[model samples]
Target: MSPARVGRVIRRCVALLLVLGLAGCGDAAAAQTGTVTVFAAASLTESFTTLGRQFEEAHPGNRVVFNFGGSSALATQINEGAPADVFAAAAPANMATVTGAAAPVTFVRNQLVIAVTDGNPKRVTGLAGLTAPGLKVALCAESVPCGAAAATALAAAGVSLTPVTLEQDVKAALAKVRFGEVDAALVYRTDAEASAADVDGIEFPESAKAINDYPIVLLKDAANPGGGQMFIDYVLSADGVRVLTEAGFQAP
Candidate 1:
């Protein structure tokens, strides 16, 4: 072949290879993007939603779908084979219920607080104040983490009183106070902070004894294991911690 012809042939081959290489790169990028369904505790709604947005922003083409509810209920769903990539529970006890999940890591801690109507109109002093005559109080069901924490705090405080209602989750309990259905509710400090416009979170000393540790793990049978692990990594990253801490979660 003439030298000019040989040079032209080489250029054509190089261009073809470049195109193939670009196509290969596109395929790999596509594989890395998908929706990661995360089943998380109700208390994590605000912070986890924020983290999910940040995660999606950092990983374009990827998505995060969250199912936020009571931790115990979430664990039951996971144990029953609900399709989920990640599980973040409000308590280790709930995390322990999952049969097939990566080793759990405590990501954050939350303490209980009395969520009262705005302006402290009830003059509720502390946990003991809930015992006053006709004082209605809402508490999380004992089966849920918030409820268990409330039980622990009440026990530690040595105060005994029946709540007007036992809600399924912290948010529901907080809602009781927000709607004025109850005089107060024992809820996570973060939940109260999230609803600051409607209620005031009253911190008490006994809450120290009942702080709940938040745990996260990737499900072993996750449909998108890689995406699951990536979301877990982001939750433990500095940026994730910043978001959680700013929202009243304590680093674990």
Candidate 2:
């Protein structure tokens, strides 16, 4: 073979090898499977956990991981560039913290309720009863969504009572009641329902004025955008709504 012809043949082979290597890289990227991280409100622990498992079951190669905390804290983490696929917040105010997130959708609504020890051991009847002097009370901090809602309800009812402790999230407030550390705590109706076996919920007309809307959105920097969207769609589906309803969340 001529030397020039040999050189041309070698050049073509090198080019072909380069193209094949690039194609292999693309294939590897497409085949990669990763866990989807979800940041959600503390109040969503039970329902979201159940849904996360269902999501993982539906997506065989993918996993669902959750970070549940106060909605405000989760929003802050997302805004600070946390690697999260989805964010489900308990209030619109907290959702607003994350700029550039996909348009948020209101998935459910929640109302504040007074949680007391099981069997009405304290004989607490309504919001007024929580004001009794020396009655230990736990409340979410005013900065958290649940605490803000409690404040709204109290204001609307013309009732003001000092809480013995201010917690960072609804779950913490509920925990106080569950542990018998406080006589009562103001928490979401869903939270109260979740702990029904250990506590009783008291309905008050004031809760109507402080209903909270839960919003969900896909993070702009989601590592698994497709999976995140699928999870969000499932949560908005009829089956998901049924689960939320059973957990005591009102329809949005």
TM-score of each: 0.89, 0.86
- Computed on alpha carbons, the lDDT of every model, listed in order, comes to 0.94, 0.91
Q: What would the per-residue lDDT of candidate 2 be over residues 1-252, giving only the tens digit for each residue?
A: 999999999999999999999999987655545688999999999999898888677666778899999998888888888889999999999999887798999999999889999997888888999998889999999889999999998999899999999999999999999999999999999999999999999999999999999999998889889778888988998878988999999998
Q: Pairs clashing in candidate 1?
A: none
Considering only N, C-alpha and C atoms within 3 Å, which residue pairs clash in candidate 2?
none
Model 1 gets an lDDT of 0.94
- TM-score: which candidate is best? 1
Deviation in Å, model 1, residue 60 alpha carbon:
0.6
What TM-score does candidate 2 get on C-alpha atoms? 0.86
Worst 10 residues of 2 by lDDT: 27-36
TM-score: model 1 vs. ground truth: 0.89
